[model samples]
Target: MGDGHSQVAQKDKYVAIIDQDKVTDEVRNIALRYDPLNRAGRREGFHVTENGELHIDDEAVIEEHKIVANRIPNDAIKIVRLPAERGELVHQYGENGFRLYELPAPVKGTVGLLGRNGIGKSTALRILGGTLKPNLGAVSDEPDWDTVIREFRGTAVQNYLEKLRDGGVSTAYKPQQVDRIPDRYDGTVRELLIVRDERNLRDKAIERLNLEHIADAFVDDISGGELQRVAIAATLVADVDAYLLDEPSSYLDVGQRLSVARTLEEFVEDKMVLVVDHDLVTLDVVSDDFHAFFGDPAGFGVVSRPLSARRGINQFLEGNLRDENVRIRDTPIDFLRPSARQEMDGIPILEFPALTKKFQSFSLGVESGTIFGKEILGIFGRNGLGKTTFAKLLAGALEPDEGRVDADINISYKPQYLDSSFDGTVVELFAGQVDVYTRAFETEIQQPFDLEPLFDLVVGELSGGELQRVSIALALARDADIYLLDEPSAYLDVEQRMSFAATLRQFVNRNGAPCLIIDHDLLLLDYVSDRAMVFEGESGVSGVGRSPQSVRKGINRFLKIVDVTFRKDPNTGRPRANKPGSQKDREQKASGNYYAV
Candidate 1:
């Protein structure tokens, strides 16, 4: 109190929480008690003193309130001790960042790792797979698994590691980046899978992964999705006691994703399996239980105990671990009711006539539609249904065979295929494209998109999620009448997707610009879209894109095509895919409400 003045009688402990934005009279008095010379005649707008004093300057620009760093002496502040941990694997990064991965010693069945990206999921997987040995929180010359096992002496993970050390257990791992397979192996799909086919299940694995069409294709020539499937199939064909898969649904479609999940469950039902994925729905469907990872992304993390599939997802959405009494995230992710008011009756910004485009073996036709002002149009369909083709047509990258978008509009588009070939850093990229230093850009684009941390990093070196955030931020930074984002949710985690959806919706409302987002994330579409567009018909051969309609109706139509019914969770309002013949599913199907509220 009184700016730490000893004359005012210094106490052993004191804490004063001040509102940084609106400095109160009492707070100003406290500041003056320390520095009586602090005054108001500093500049245009406000004078923010280095000593945490605020002065009224009419011509000064008001700075946004930020969290102030603690600068008191070490003896002045009390330290809150964290609970002690005796985990199987403990890895440290920098001085304070580390991961306390607490897993069952001898992992059983299929347990999943759920969390935001860069929070130590991959590290945990690698440590378990014997690729990276655990150090047990030490910086010694040799980090040994023996010490790690000793730390978990009375734990199941210790037993698991002991068996592994004795060569009694084996493991097969599938890394997150499937494209890297081409870097290590130049062989064909069949060759890759058969090499790891110690169980003689290569043929079944290929069939299950839908690799029959590209069975003989070289790894270098196949698509991203194809590479992912091949990688999974290769690992599945191995005769290992445990399997570790990271982001198995990265580039897959709905049907392909389901098929892969089913195959994984069937092949490794009796073995120990651990998966790390961001798609909540797919994770819910595939995993029997979950180990939720919590803490600062890319900095520190703690893996929690096992939670049932349904409970895990719901708790993640709620941003809290009920059992541990730990809050992983700031706010709960809750969705507004479908019947809530949205920008439904806004004026039309762009009108398109029935459009058609044809390629060598595929053709796409879209029914006429109008995108309302300040509204987001959600596009849903499986892969190869010409979604990208449709986007390019609207972007004027391709000519329609029949009709056209017809409207004269400036568009900001983030394409499905991102070219990470930039030779400059993220800061330089933003400098050459948008004014990243401005307040508006910092608030609306940089902060919400979490692009600040990647500013100094080279564009080409960024990961999938990092690259995606950059591409999307660039798109949003530009001045355009219409925003076209194809699969914007592709590489983003669940939290990132929801954050972007909220930001995009706010941007639309503020700028009065309509946006069309084509993505496969149902919860994202449900959260961001004011209306929806359903694309149907045969994949890769013939496709149809229907006109935009109400969000409920459009989603219902699309889900009907997929033959899956979704109902909102009562607690969080997030979509939960119903069981095949569950009461909710049966009721929704009978009532013809696939996207039930």
Candidate 2:
């Protein structure tokens, strides 16, 4: 067996060398296609060996080929590693808590710390940022944070400055929650640019990020997604070597997410950028390295391959299931059942008659049978489309100017901006409201959704998924006949999104309630929704309603323009598209965009 293994290893080495030669030849051919002037230079080094192999020694080509060999270890930076301790209290009630179990050397470039709700990912980040100190674990390198900083000031002063100047190391943290700007101090987005010492570079940053429209808007009233972008903009304006962004894409939609990923890629070209996000799709595209924090006391974490990031995250959330390979199911979901349609009583819960929404120049109509009990409705459109506006109109937050909105039934609306809407603990949001629906549903809400541990926890401290669950609980706790959930599953991870869908299904099945969910996650939409609405056109006002299968077909047809193919998810059976080639395959797979049929 050892001999056979040795032979296989030898063969693998030869194959690798052969592959490298092939790649070199391909690179030369492609370079020659565009740079005709370099042909003579390339010919100087071009040769065919006795084995009939092409070789090139062009200086530029050789330099380009040396990129892999020239790669520097980014993990060389001296990180203050902490020794792992048992059950150390990182936080003592109300304050942020973290306990480091194994402080792996900073070999992985820009580690991403991901975990389930309340698992202390944010707390761990704060500890690394020097904002919070773990009560239990000690730094592996003798001196504590203060001592390290002082030591840097004392002996390593020149080295630290040199590192900073050479862009060898720097770290900045952007919190998941946006803090309130001082009311007395009014400032435009451009003014906030000055805070980061980018007053002169404001236009460059804005143009790069495409934030011209909201450049003058007050920092206070921008949309949640826009606010998130602004926060990122503030960080990008600063010249840093590393950035720790917590849930940067929490409020962004599909388009904005793509834009943000592009921006981060540019940023990471010269510096390490660690973005802790719940959206697996964005992470797959943006991250070069991935890390996950799991287990009790939340100390255990594993640095995983980038390709397996999504699977690792899912496994962490759901536990190691038997079918590990099948991460997502692609089965088409039935949003509404026959029984649900029969129980509608012929009265429309809410109808938008030629609903022409403001800010978005489009119109549509929704009838009674269109949305039935316990049905998940996916409202999809391009960004700047009136999806949010339409949601606001349904929620009674905005009055329609032209069309009649017949929301004759009791409705509970969970808006997109959950942070500003509610203030208090998770318990407080549903405490008084739970009893009101208990008698109606004939089942105690607390029993179905366990609100005990979450009673005292502040709402503001909750993760996006936790807050989303809380929002759903609060909405479900109410005795409303209809639910208008705007981007209900926006910030939730794969597990949370699925769990929320099940909860929504239960709400409809148990209490005969209906819901309209505006979301960008097509997979979730396929699973939970009974009907799909696709809003098209540049303004995204007009929409076409169709079945899940039909919608998949339409999406596939549209995505074909980009040379991508949509396939059924093996786990859930939802439709998903993927780009051609292994690079795009790895990216799409890592992103968790693979849908179920």
Candidate 3:
């Protein structure tokens, strides 16, 4: 009896330890099941020893691993482990190559594929969708589209389809480029739904995405955020068993992003969804399982424990934030004046006069020269405000129905969708048209901005944050007297955003070049801008001018009013403050938090 009780206690202790480890034994089994070698060795349980030493054992517990691996035909498994060097060429770019290995069987429910940019996230999605083939990997049990349709044609087909259609595994894919929608679709929102056989699912998607008003507008004419939602709507209407979405929240506002998160919850209840995105914030809200891939010569590959399920997903998010490759920091441009009034009496670089654009129920004045050389002008507004529209008009891409735009000096505008403007390699842009600026800002652009290796890489293929950095580099390389940027730090992580703010300040100081930027990144706005214009009131959109000091006050007041929670550093219990430029000064002021406003 004593020996039996001891054995029971030991067993209970093992279970207790596994439970304390956070990930369950079931999850470990699932991960190991994908690799048959693990199962064959009887190494399938949560722990190798009683203490849980050699491995944490959580990798095997992924819920979808069992379902996906089970679905994969035996032929696919045979091909997955083929020699990497001998595989058929799947995709080839300058230094990037991709070869498909055996397709992992589709998982039972939604699955998320995560990784940094340049890791073939999109390429993998394409392979799964049958739009692209793997160069070196073998594909077995490839589902035939014609067979699916023909096999399910009649009553006889329905009976035969039971095994295939157990739960209806449909697929909807949203590409990375939001601007890639066909230029000639003459269908209304309702019409597009019908075309996609998603008319019934349209209302739910629309309500979740907040797209009731622009249902009838042309796809090309809507705002970037609206367009993204519409694309989601089109995908949702398909009611696929799984979804392949690439940066689905790229242009959405904060509120809209949260809404999309909720919608994803409803959409993926019993389906498999793979998403490729750089927005860690949005991904955190939606992901069930995480698979991270890193770029390599052969192809992008997965990281088993991308993040610890025990420590939770926040650690993974921080890892992404700290990755230097995806972060961008613009050189600080230092202007002579400390205030907006201290401008040199020269030709106004750019001007907006009585510029009013009205869509449905909103209007704003796109005012002029309030912007001067080397000055950082910050434009502030609410989510639905015309800040983005104002940026488009200033860039000369959108024609304002009510006002005229005049440029006294050369101007370069960085649109909100910075990726769309990039058509060539980074090196081509530097040496081709903007060579002189690159030579002038050689030290800053090369070292601080870090555009060296990216010179050979295609700009269109870069991640969102990476593209933003490239856009800043391209703009700084230009000789234009005035620079216009819209949400320059939208996609950047905390560190990159700080560096970008400093860089903008440095640039303003060196050349006294004028810059106007519209953004919701308040910390950046406060750090760089000498003057700010707050867009308030009804249709008139009054510009309440404020000094940097006063602007800080306004921001603090607004934050208090809104009750937004600021993130605190895990290492240091205090609220995380922006890094100070001078280490000595930062040390001196380390005792207290720097409160703006």
Best by TM-score: 1
**Tens-place lDDT digits, model 1, residues 1-597:** 012211212222111222343355444554333321234442332234676655432111122211111322111111111233312336754222344445533367788788888777888887788766666556435556676666665555767778777788889998876766787899999988878899899999988887887898899877677888898998998998999998888767666777887898788868999888988778888888788887656545678777888888889878888887767777886644442437578888888899998887788989998888898888988766788788888888888999967558888889876667789999999899878779999888888887866887899888878988999999989989889998788767777887788898889889898989988777778777888888899765789999888777877887888778888777676677787789989999999999776
Q: Report the C-alpha lDDT of model 3 over 415-474, residue by residue, as the tens digit.
A: 776654557877777677665344566776765676664666787677666787888867
TM-score of each: 0.82, 0.65, 0.58
Model 1 scores a C-alpha lDDT of 0.73
Off by over 4 Å in 3: 1-114, 130-168, 182-186, 197-199, 295-301, 306-313, 317-361, 365-383, 392-410, 417-433, 436-438, 441-470, 487-506, 519-597
Question: Model 2 residue 366 lDDT?
Answer: 31
RMSD values for the candidates in order, in angstroms, are 10.0, 21.1, 16.0
Which ranges of candidate 1 are over 4 A from the true structure? 1-89, 104-106, 141-143, 179-188, 216-224, 335-341, 570-573
* lDDT comparison, 1 vs 3, better candidate: 1
Residue 510 lDDT, candidate 3, scale 0-100 = 82
Candidate 3 C-alpha error for residue 197, in Å = 4.1
Residue-wise lDDT of candidate 2 within 17-76, one digit each (tens)?
Answer: 112222354443443343333444545333445655443321223323323322212211
Clashes of each: 7, 29, 46
Number of the predicted model whose lDDT against the real structure is largest = 1
